[model samples]
Target: MRRFNLKEFRSERNLTQKQLIAKTGIPNVTITQIENGHKSLSKELRKRIFDAFQVDERLYVA
Candidate 1:
């Protein structure tokens, strides 16, 4: 699976995966997998991620 540059975004936002998990209520493992491109997101998870990062959905899904 192709990875989204989630780590870059997080760095830009000065957030760690642990911080993101805390903010989004996503598990750390799930965040790790998403960052590593080992997992695809469900709609709900995607929404949470978007909310956490304040990013447009198109940026992620495209």
Candidate 2:
């Protein structure tokens, strides 16, 4: 899968980290780490993010 473009996605949606947390139920630090590439997207986190964005995972994976 390609890297999750958290920063770009958030920017496009005008969503702050806190707002994303509220929307996705992901912890703030984890979101920060993911955005900074310090962490990888686990299956569960990807699912949560996809659900929040209402996106299909096939669009992310080859």
Give the C-alpha miss distance for residue 40 in model 1, angstroms: 1.0
Tens digit of per-residue lDDT, candidate 1, span 1-62: 23446677778789978888888999989878977889877788877878876777775534
- Tens digits of per-residue lDDT for model 2, 1-62: 56558788799899999999999999999999989999987899888888988988877662
User: Local error of candidate 1 at 42, Å?
Assistant: 2.3
Q: Look at candidate 1 and give me any clashing residue pairs.
A: none
Badly placed stretches (over 4 Å) of model 2 are 1-3
Error of 1 at 12 (Å): 1.4
Q: Could you tell me every candidate's TM-score relative to the true structure?
A: 0.70, 0.82
Q: What is the lDDT of residue 30 in candidate 1?
A: 82
Please estimate how well model 2 matches the true structure, expressed as its whole-model Cα lDDT: 0.85
